[model samples]
Target: MTSVLALTAATAQADAFNRIASFPTHLNNAEANAESSAEIISATADGMTLVYSDSPLEVIGLIDITDPANPKAKGNIAVGGEPTAVSVIGNTAFVGVNTSESYTAPSGMIKAFDLATMTETAVCDLGGQPDSTAAAPDGSFIAVAIENERDEDLGDGRTGQLPGGFLVTVDVVDGSLDCDTVNVIDVTGIAEISPEDPEPEFVDINAAGEIVLTMQENNHMVVATKDGVINHFSAGQVDLENIDATDERGALVFTESQPNRLREPDAVQWIDDNHFAIANEGDMDGGSRGWTIFNKDGTEVYENGTGFEKAIIAAGHYPDKRSDSKGVEPEGMEFGIFNDTPMAFILAERSSIVGVYDLTDPSAPVLAQLLPSGVGPEGAVAIPGRNLFVTANEVDLIEDGGVRSHVMIYELTDAAASYPQLTSAGTDELIGWGAISGMSAGAGSTVYAVNDSFYGYQPTIFTIDTATTPATITDATVVTRGGHPAQKLDMEGVYFDGEGFWIASEGRTDRMIPHGLYHVDMDGNIDAEIPLPAELLAVERRFGFEGITRVGDTLWMAVQREWADDPENHVKLVAYNLETEQWGAVHYQKADPDTGWVGLSEIVAHGDYVYVIERDNQIGGAAVTKKIYRIAAADMVAAPLGDDLPVVSKEEVRDLIPDLTSLNGYVVDKIEGLAIMEDGTAWISTDNDGVDDSSGETYFWSPGKF
Candidate 1:
């Protein structure tokens, strides 16, 4: 059964999660230059404030969500140690601090703070490293998972090290912790694997005062009643079929199988007194790549095998680079009753998506929605009273000039779902597409786009139908050479010729991929290959052709950046005559960068002029130039190679900053595709870097009939 949450605008009008606001973690950091992250979030009883643990900064950051549409940063509080988890009861926040010196001597504490005064109230020594914390639903006590946490490099990265983990329960009276009432419960010899090293990963309590814990490395589950009586069971394993089990292969193939794969669960949440759910984020031996529901007595109720993964692939959010490690990596989970319906929110850490399931019937839950999160969603909190949902994304890519760690807010409303602007849901077969570099208009409303070097082993041209809202990919044709999947090709651009497509393969000479052009038939069979002339090859750089377009008998290629022989702030618009068999060039002056370098990304020819996408390499707020400029055909006079190329004048057609941020996200760096239809309607798209270290959000829309 394909568990696809096929949500469209018309069908999602009842109640859906729609993103309303995003707050970057850096806004609360005092250093401004230091990296910070938002992880393990908890909300106040009023549901107006959010607090998250920031281990990198050794602090706990706060955000005011009174107005869910405009989240305000409340700054950070120094915790003096690594804060592992946080939970709130009334006006006080309970934080678990890890101060472990070594695996053999793990030590930590539980720090309680008063929200009104913003001061520490009390602390209880846990005597072990704490990983997760949860407050009793009735506010009577708090539970902490004391994970001694074995070192992966020691003993082959398995468990069974010294000082096994345990659980700590503390009495809470009027939002204040009673340090003397702390009770430690030993959870040893519970699982079949590494029974001596029960590394407790997560904890949650139900309304009946029963605490459930997950021993991730041990592949075990434990349930402790309020009176300290415990029952334990093994998480067990499952048979996985139709999965991509290899890593970094530059392709997505789901034909492999892994039988008896262990479900080393990470985050567990009690849905009711008798049932709960676990995110199977395996640690030592296995990760099943999906979630499972279990009865309180360890009876397997429902296991969503590869169905959840298939849905993520259909939505174009699969993480191909993590195929071998843990596909999608479902790491966090939260359960709540919203609008009288029990809902489960499962967080896929690598894919940066939140899967919302309606648990009206726990035996067979319905996949309702898939919410787009930040780069890595590690924790989630549901504010059902306010009809709101919050997620803490833990990835901060500041060093790579990418978006910082963010906390995203979503509201449950009757409005239609706004995310997933592009999907492969209605296609004949499952299609995965990302890193869209260049595009060309085909017959009618169809457009053809090519993936870049990210999928070097499976170069494919995708056919997108723009007539549908949130355009859908209808077909994908694998680009072939000698009747086999092409290799060593970094296809950046595609142009629909009279018979087939003229493709521009951006080359890296260091990797032996020469800068060249290839003509492929409609069936994706290469018919001809043309190498750069001697004059251009001598001056070529790794940043070669980015886009290609055909104008009558000539083909124009937009050089991405300045070559060895080009002037500063200018790149060549090289032209090759199909009939004359000659090569020439013209320089197109680009904008100077405010921080990083700027260059051209795409080129297209219309009636009387040609349009090109010019952008800066900087992302988010640091970006300066992301626009479309046009050069009149009369000024595109190609000069012979080895001679001074005449520079062409440009006219600004559109400023794309608004379009890039229209979806309420930080601006992406790669605006690499442009397609104009026969009716003069213009369309543009941004490359998602194949969801590798990316938010996996692709924007494909028009700038109002340019």
Candidate 2:
């Protein structure tokens, strides 16, 4: 078994990064309905202001980090086209604007804005579509990666689609760009894979006036000096073993292997003048699922193999759905020296995690911490002068009513890491778990929880030990049928039945998964399946059973939303008798949502009441109701279905908004699991939607006596 002693003691460290604030990108836009994003962020010389490229809004957003704990929006400036990247030198912000007409006819420019006046000061025609921009440390010149990125749909998505890309270097004096001195460096015949198409994805300049660039699709790297002389090398390849290589399989199996995988790096940053690090975010055929450190002479110093992805898996942040592709997709990276210690921050695009590593010994870097970001962290900026680090998350989920793109800020201090409130870290085998849907108290301080349909092919029951500071998942049991993992189950609720457990599967008729109750032994072996009766099935909707609780010989199930036969704002509390095998129901009134629909998420029977978690479908600031209400156990008399059921009265037990926002993140929509112990200690958790377009932040906390 993996040793828990070290993992538990590691939490006592006093030096770590802690998130302080999050600023939504939409706040910079004048229209609330329009979608916005924060990508490719850069900080000013004073390290008090932040500027990010917003491609969807075609603008560059500015934020005042004068007070890093509570960032304020400073509005946006139109870049006239899609803003791809931004870099701030002194008080001026240089943005790369993409105005591509087609893959064959790519066009872009570099627009410099005076942040003090919020006005465009200079515009230099880049002569091709640009992907990334970087300013020299000495402010002598600025480098732009003219990507002329390939059209994935054309020519089988290869890089050799012609009209290849190059690099541009422009002189800068007194914080102003001299457009007349723009120099376009031709970078062709560089790599054997795509010798004709050089798609430079990212650029970074060191203190020695040398520029390092990554041609992502071509799988090559180029180091250009001040005189425009270039030294190019192939990014090379890696052999991957013990990884999950199948996509959409609904399970995480790491027995697969892929040999000779290309390290098609995306983002590169110089740790010093002689060495640099590259995030191997492969495009088509590779993604080593790690970062690499290399010398200026093309000698590989260190290759992280599957170590980074494995760490993410231990933190329950692995994107199992993207297993077949670039797992975790480490895309952006930043290097800085904080407290005299060199550090490297690696951003995982798919996992939404930022790995902070201490480069005290360049050859042997140590992972310090893993901080959670918004949905997709596209870029990061580290300001050691202020002991601050920032990430620009580029995903805007407005269409799904989810949290918008955010710019998360973290402060480096002598404090313990406040994140990763829950983990399966010390387990003997890696336990990849998320989307915690239902929970029930087991024997003593133990609790049993089940994952939703996100792991449909590997439905599991996790055993948690809640005595630790951050609860630990001690073991996992796969809910199996005929010795095989049960399939087509969207388990939403689970209840302890004195021996084993009774699970409620929320059905989706469209997906061929039916609504039912399952009886499983302690080992998670499905002994029986009980389908919903015809009387309830006739009125059932996709939002069926959400929670289950047992009292005496009756099983109580909370229906998620209103059904066809139920009154408006009223859902049924279904009851099933174990002795008589009869079904009954009771009406439970819920508050009407102001924007989205309100529904019941969890149900748990306590000493004198049945506690239910009532929530709305809306997330973030739009959420109206996230509460727990209790119904008197004496009022749980069930009436036969197909008749007017007695409406149960409820008393507000707690408003979960405070607990949801306790970590400073926006309110999540899914508060789907609750487990109350015999001592009245209640534990609650939120569903992360299996980290699919979600922040992948599962909040598990105890509200004390309920």
TM-score for each model: 0.97, 0.97
User: Candidate 1: misplaced stretches above 4 Å?
Assistant: 1-14
Q: Compared to the true structure, candidate 2 yields what TM-score?
A: 0.97
- Clashes per prediction? 0, 0
Candidate 2: global Cα-lDDT? 0.90
**Between which residue pairs do clashes occur in model 1?**
none
Q: Give candidate 2's root-mean-square deviation (CA, Å).
A: 3.1
Candidate 2, residue 97: Cα displacement in angstroms equals 1.2
Compose the digit string of candidate 2's lDDT tens values, residues 131-228. 99999998888999999888899888877788899999998877888999899888887687888889999999999999999988888989997566
State the RMSD for candidate 1.
3.2
User: Residue 146 of model 2: what lDDT?
Assistant: 96
lDDT of model 1, residue 453 = 90
Model 2 — which ten-residue stretch has the worst lDDT? 1-10
Question: What is the per-residue lDDT of model 1 for residues 1-706, given as tens digits with 9 covering 90 to 100?
Answer: 1111123222334577888888898989777779999999999999999999999998888999889898998978888799999999987889999999887889999999887788899999999999999999999999999999998999998887988999999999768999999999988876788888789999999999999999998888999975664688888898999888899889878888889999999999999999999999887888999999999898999999987888898878899998987899999999989999999999999998989999999999989988989999999999999999999999999888788899999899887777777788877667877888899999998999999999989899998988876678899999999999988888998999858999999998777888999999999999999999999999999999999998889999999999999989999999999999899999999998888899999999999999999999988778889999999988888999999999999999988887666556678899999999988888788898989888887777766465
